[model samples]
Target: MKIMIMRHGEAEATALSDGQRPLTEEGINEVTQVAELVAEEYVVSKIIASPLLRAQQTASLMATGLNLPAVDTLTELAPEHKPESVLKALASEEAEVLLLVSHMPLVDQLAGWLLEGSRMSPIAFPTATVAVLHTDHLAAGVAELERVFLAPS
Candidate 1:
């Protein structure tokens, strides 16, 4: 299976809470463009995102771009959580290509854990960045970092 880990699009700086922040217009456009790229190059079966507003919006954009019908929200994908729990939850996913949208630190950490089995995250994910990983068995250090698509400039 292939896991497409993505960081949410750019968001407003102020909100009642961080989770309430919505995507900026630029962010929406950029994510829409990137989603087009993804649709052109890959086959995505499922989209999972953090429950936060920006992430949810990003997932909705991605779902629209990919011609998908649903986006599943996982609380474990929130910024405050660690990668292990999300990874564990995703272990049972049978999709050929599964997409996950979340925030930094968690996105970085999850990519790091999947790539090297450590706490250090190597890639710097700009807003709406997507990292594709391939693995037969869902476990740390067993997945290969296939490629990464950066956010628009």
Candidate 2:
């Protein structure tokens, strides 16, 4: 299976709540370019995103760019959520290629958990960055980080 983890694009520093933050104009452009490039490289089957507004917007852009149906919301993808929960939920999904648009630390942590079996991220997860992993099953220390896509600055 191929799992792609993407951080939401640049967003307002503050909102009524963290979940309410929206993507900036530049963020939209950046993520759009990144998504288009990824679409060219892989056949994205499903898109899952955090419920947070910024991630939702990012996922919507990715879905449209990839010609996908719609983005599915998973609260477990929130910034503070644990990578274990996300992995557990994804284990039941049937998509051969999946894209998850989410927030920072969690995105980083998830990558780390999949590749190294630790909570420490091996790579930096800048906004609008996407990391690709290939694994037979979604388990700790069992996946390989195949590649990464960084949206133009």
Candidate 3:
């Protein structure tokens, strides 16, 4: 399976809670560019995103660019949720190509867990960054990092 993980585009900082924040204009443009790149290179069957506004917006834009049916909002993608649970849920979908739009620590943590077990996060997830992973099993330390895409600033 091919899974692509993307950190939601840059969001406004004035919301009452993180979940309420929305992406900035620059964020939309940046994520759109990244999405176009993904569309040119991959066939995406599914796009799952956190219910948070920023993630939702990001996912919607990416889905549109990828010509996907729609974006599915998964609460499991919330910033504080566990990557294991997300993986399990995704496993059931059986999509050949899946895109996940989510937040900080969790996105980076998920990447580290998938690529290097519990050892460490070898890289930072900049806003609108996307990492591609190839995996036969949906368990930790079993996936290989295929490549990364960074949206222009």
Candidate 4:
């Protein structure tokens, strides 16, 4: 299966709470562009995103652009959650190409855990960045980094 781990787009610096922060106009534009690129480049079967406002917004944009079904929200993708949790949440997913929209640290951590099997975060996920990987098993150190689509700030 192919997985595309993505960081949410740029968001407001402050909100009632971190989870309430919304995407800025610049964030919307960049995410739109990146979503278009993803739509053109790959066949995404599912989109699962963090419940945070900004992440949901990014996922919504990508869903619209990709013509995918409604976006699914996952608390495991939250910034404070661990990659193992997200992996557990996705254990039964049957999508060939899955898109996971999440926060920075979690997305970076998840991708690293998927690729190296240990604590190693090699990819830097600036806002609106997406890294694609493939694996036969969900275990660590077995997935291959197929490509990355980075939407420059």
Note the Cα lDDT for every prediction shown. 0.92, 0.93, 0.88, 0.92
Error of 4 at 62 (Å): 0.2
Give the best candidate by TM-score. Answer: 2
Question: CA shift at 139, candidate 4, in angstroms?
Answer: 1.1
Give the lowest summed-lDDT range of ten residues in model 1.
115-124
lDDT score of residue 76 within candidate 4: 94
The best candidate in terms of lDDT: 2
Ranking by lDDT: 2, 1, 4, 3
Please give, for residues 1-153, the per-residue lDDT of candidate 1 as tens digits: 999999999999999999999999999988999999899899899999999999999999999999999999999999999989988888678999999999988999999888888757677899999999998877788789888888668
| Per-candidate clash tally | 0, 0, 0, 1
Query: Who is ahead in TM-score, 1 or 3?
Result: 1
TM-score of 3: 0.95
- Once superposed on the true structure, which residue ranges of model 4 sit more than 4 Å away at CA? none
**TM-score of every prediction relative to native:** 0.97, 0.98, 0.95, 0.97
lDDT of 2 by residue, 1-153 (tens): 999999999999999998899999989998999998898899999999999999999999999999998889998999989999998888789899999999889999999999999989887898899999999989999999899999976
Residue 45, candidate 1: Cα error in Å is: 0.3
Comparing 2 with 4 on lDDT, the higher-scoring candidate is: 2
> In terms of TM-score, how similar is model 2 to the real structure?
0.98
Badly placed stretches (over 4 Å) of model 2 are none
Error of 3 at 73 (Å): 1.3
